[model samples]
Target chain A: MATIETTGLTKSFGDVHAVEDLDLTVEEGEIFGFLGPNGAGKSTTINLLLDFIRPTSGNIEVLGIDAQERPAAVRRRVGVLPEGFGFDDPLLGREYLEWAIETKEADDDPDELIDLVGLTGDADRLAADYSTGMQQRLAFAMALAGDPDLLILDEPSTGLDPNGIQNMREIVREQAERGTTVFFSSHHLAEVEAVCDRVGVMNEGELVAVDTIEGLRESAGGPATIQLECATPPTELGVADLDVVTDVAVDERTLSVTCTGASAKVDVVTHVAERAEIVDILSESVSLEALFNDLTDGGRDGDDADSEQAATEVAQ
Target chain B: MSVRTVAKQDFLSARRSRALWFATTLFALLAVLIAYGSQGYRLSATEQVQNTFRSFGMVLAVLLPIVALVASYMSIAGERESGGIKFLLSFPNTRRDVFLGKLASRLAVVAAGLTFIFLAATAVAVARHGAFPVGVVLGTYLVSLLYGSVFVAVAVALSSAVGARSRAIGAAVGSYFVLIVLYLVPTIRITALVQWVHDTMLGMEPNPHLYDAVTYTSPYIAFRKALNLVLPTEMQQEVFRGSLEAGGELPVYLTDEFSLVVFAVWLTVPLVVGYVRFEGSDLE
Candidate 1:
């Protein structure tokens, strides 16, 4: 079953369309990464899903329940960690978690959840006194209190050290293993690449692509590059005849073949080994960071042109 | 249950605010001082208690609204500013829960403070004079509570209407000045000026009934008139004899029941407006 689904969702703040014609779906028990730049409408989409804001048009469903019609029911089963969230009260971390537990009507131990988020010693201190990283950890613990069926974390790793980020990744993996649907938004491409089963890249209020990391890499442009070091240079290797090999370059005894997919790597290796002895081979796949930049930068130029045209029309 | 939970949280935060504690203490001290000072005068017990009620009513007419504004001006606006509303709404609670919870909690704080001061004043009055009128004291306290609630509702409504903390603070203070100071002060001055002009220049008497109706538009004045009905009949005559003599009788519209209804309107209208505005907003 889909944990979250939205169809043609649109939200506009006057002339600025914050989210436009968004269609999305997240299956149960999958870690779906929502990636976008600062103003690409990631938060707006999440807000619509949580029913924090009413949509200008379209429908949203969470756990098969219409979110707009029954937000409280959806909220009861979903945990959210909103961006820029702060504790204005002088409540201790443990007390805040306990409040969240009561709010969710769950029996989870606050102390245990605090420890899980690496906020053990800081649980008794006032949350107002916590540093940004500590506050993030405490909020994560609160979100984990109810054993929720769905988790929506917006920029959950905004303020965290490397060790804290590692702990967050482990917790996300653990939750996904427990069949909890995890939908999170982040600018940290590497983190999303590590844990996300599927990723949706949004730009200018629209989703550009949604696919697995490897698939996104392929869609961005060519696949993995295989670098082979051979014992003898194969002068008679006509690799240009194969469709999988986009390009092949030979530098002394080293052969570099760019394949369209993982399957092409073996074919190239076999063809090279038939002519020359293969010593070592190295494959380098495209990083999500590079693919994300490629996709968003392209989208940004288009957005700039559209806005410029709008500005000209207004002037006229 | 959600409303209670939100209210409890707000109450706990209010308890931690040093400003609220300071306001409550100052009000209590002032009440005690007034109660003790009245005892020095050589008068009957009824006169002493009536004096106490009159003096306390005057002080609370100014003091309670300020305290109520201070207690509630930041209730929703501060949460919205600090991005805490995001965390709160992410839970199972609705926006209506938050609005009602904040109103209930602020009302509780103001009521508790007023109750403390009234009780202290009663103790002082009982210790100085041999007897105290339970009916008048309770009546004054209840009416004062209702008056404070008007300002509390106004402050919370303004807080919800504005998006930022600074704007909410400005709105609350601005409304306070308009309703309490500007509205009441100018009405008195203008009425006196008009009456003087009519008598001296036109050689005619201004209608006292018209004067009472115009002045009674101020909630503070309406509250005072309502308190007059609760006091002893002799005290009512003492306070209102000039107006009664001028008009030959009080107008039907200027009755105690009408003032009570005015106070009720002051309480209900702002609260309903704030609730509806809060419900309609995007909360971002």
Candidate 2:
């Protein structure tokens, strides 16, 4: 079942198109990442679907109900960790969790979530006294209070430390494995790429691409950057054909080339070794940092224009 | 969904807030002072009810507005600021469910606490002087809450309009003062401290016409006038007044026609306005 389906969902604040004719379908029981740069309208999109703000035009169906028309009904089935709500006050951590549990009416044992979030020891301490990482853990516990079928987590890993980030990844991945559909949005693409099975990249209020995790990487140009180390220079190199060596920069004895295809990385590395002395072997995988910069920068004008057209159509 | 649960949550939330507890407690203690601290009245059981009614009436006529302000000031604003409302709103409950549930619970707490203090004042009166007239004591406190209905609406509307907690509180408090101290200044101009300004403003010739208009135009004075009608200090006279007179008629000093309309306006206008604002606002 589709938990969320929006057709041409558009929102504008005077001249600024915050979210433009965004059409998306979120299948039940899958972790979906709404990947975008800052101000790409991830938060705005969530707010519209939650009915905190009405859409300028188009339709939003969340949890099988029209969001604008039946927000209370949709809210009943959803759980959200909103962005910028990253702060809390003097309430005790465990007590806050208990209140959330009672409010959401989720059947999970509080003690179990306490352990799951690893806050059993500091359960009585005031939440204001918690470190940023500890607070993130508490927020996670709050999101899980109701055993919600669809969880909308915005920047869930914002203040987490290194280990906390790893723990968050595990928790998110675990929820997805347990058949909960997770719709997460973040400016930090690394967080999205780590746990999200599929991703939709947006730029300037428009969704440029939506595909399986592997598919987005493939479509965005597959990763290939080779590092080599050799004992001695050999003869006869540069025989294998490489796809688009866009740029080749050299630092001391190592050469770095912007190329597509990882298999081509092996070909380049073998050839480099036959030509000169090589030191070490490394393949710079196309991390989401690289992915986002390219998409937002390269696709900004095209994405914005495309989205404005869609928005006008929805308005009509 | 249960009213009991709603009340319990409200009570707990208030208990968790030490500042709110102190502010409300101070108001209750002040009500007692208003009754006991007056000059030369016989401190008897019946007089105690009359005194408490007078003091609570005056205090709550003002304090009820404050309560209404605090209640609405925090209603949606508090939730949005703390992110607590969003968490609760995401539940199966509708906006109406959350609004009424929290409101009922908060009201129950305030009412319960006020009733206890009013009852204490009555007990003191009986122990010191004579038998208690249950009707007068109960009526004063109950009506005070009712008169405060507009304050609640105004506060709630402001809360729904903006997201800043401190700004919301300031606006509600400031607006209350405007209605009381500014527009109704001539009526409240009785204190010795303000006599100099009063002399300058009135020049020994206070205009009866201006004062009457100001009184009705001011929600605060109008509310006090409403209370004076419902519970007069003349009850301390203890005459064998007719039952119909005791239950319904206004005191000789208060004209019932205008105050009743003001009270009704306070109850309805703000609620309708606030609900409309709430329906349009972004939950963020």
Which candidate leads the pack in TM-score? 1
lDDT of residue A137 for candidate 1: 93
Backbone clash total for model 2 is: 4
Query: lDDT by residue for model 1 over B55-75, one digit each (tens)?
Result: 888888888889999989998
What's the TM-score of every candidate structure?
A: 0.90, 0.80
* Stretch of 10 with least lDDT, candidate 2 chain A: A307-316
Residue range A104-156, candidate 2, lDDT tens digits = 66677878887887777988898768887788788788788777788898878
Residue B21 lDDT, candidate 1, scale 0-100: 87
Candidate 1's C-alpha runs over 4 A off are A222-224, A240-248, A258-271, A298-316, B39-42, B186-215, B237-249
Candidate 1 C-alpha lDDT tens digits along A1-316: 6899999999999999999999999999999999988899999999888877899999999999998888878888888998888798978888888888998889998878988999878899989999999999988987887898999999988889999999999999999999999998998887898899999999989998999887886675536578899888855688867888888888988888887866688899898888788899887666666577666763455456553342222100
For candidate 2, give the docking quality class from DockQ.
Answer: acceptable
Q: For candidate 1 chain A, which ten residues in a row score worst on lDDT? A: A307-316
Where model 2 places Cα greater than 4 Å from the true spot, the runs are A86-91, A227-283, A298-316, B2-10, B39-52, B187-219, B228-261
| B-chain TM-score of model 1 | 0.87
